[model samples]
Target: MAPGGPELLLIVGIAVLLFGAQKIPALARSIGESAGQFKKGQAQVEQELEEIKPDASGAGSAGAGTDAETDLES
Candidate 1:
């Protein structure tokens, strides 16, 4: 079951008590920066995958050439 208002309030209160108001902003900023870095890394990986995809197609054509050479040798 989902938390109701009181439960949500209690959780927030606990967070404030543990971290204090002054620290919360810094914590949030760090989390935002981390998330941004994660997104940047994910985009880099996607771009690399796109680049490799063309090489994969080229490899298939190269394999076909090898087969042709084998047939000529036979």
Candidate 2:
């Protein structure tokens, strides 16, 4: 009834009883590591997108079409 589910609360209570005061720092360290990894991955993805961005002169065509094709004999 606490919104997370009875099984989750039971597990959390068991963990607290077992670890007491010694596990809080370790859990926080693990959460920090996860957050740092997520941010690093997000930054790398954004950098890659910026690198592939096209210019305003239309020279960065990504295989859509070429303007010189209309004058060819084909």
Candidate 3:
């Protein structure tokens, strides 16, 4: 679950007290940039998984269990 409004305000107030008003903006900006980078990396990994999904899900996979299937047949 996410934090409530009061909790959020309290966190922000604590941050302001700890970092001061001027530094808060810079800190927030850096946090946003880091989150964006994280999202981009996540998207790239998801894309790679999608690209590999078809290969694993029946595409060119028929031959993969050929030996196992033959062993079972015997």
Error of 3 at 51 (Å): 0.6
Which lDDT values do the candidates have, in the order given? 0.94, 0.76, 0.93
Task: By lDDT, rank the candidates, best first.
Answer: 1, 3, 2
lDDT tens digits, residues 5-58, model 1? Answer: 999999878889999989988988999999999999999999999999989899
Q: Score every model by TM-score.
A: 0.65, 0.49, 0.71
Q: Please provide the root mean square deviation of candidate 1 (C-alpha atoms, Å).
A: 5.5
TM-score of structure candidate 1: 0.65
* Candidate 3 residue-wise lDDT, 26-69, digit = tens: 99999999999999999999999999898788756677689779
Model 1, residue pairs in steric clash: none
Ranking of all predicted structures according to TM-score, beginning with the best and ending with the worst: 3, 1, 2
| Candidate No. with top lDDT | 1
Candidate 2 TM-score over all chains jointly: 0.49
lDDT of 3: 0.93
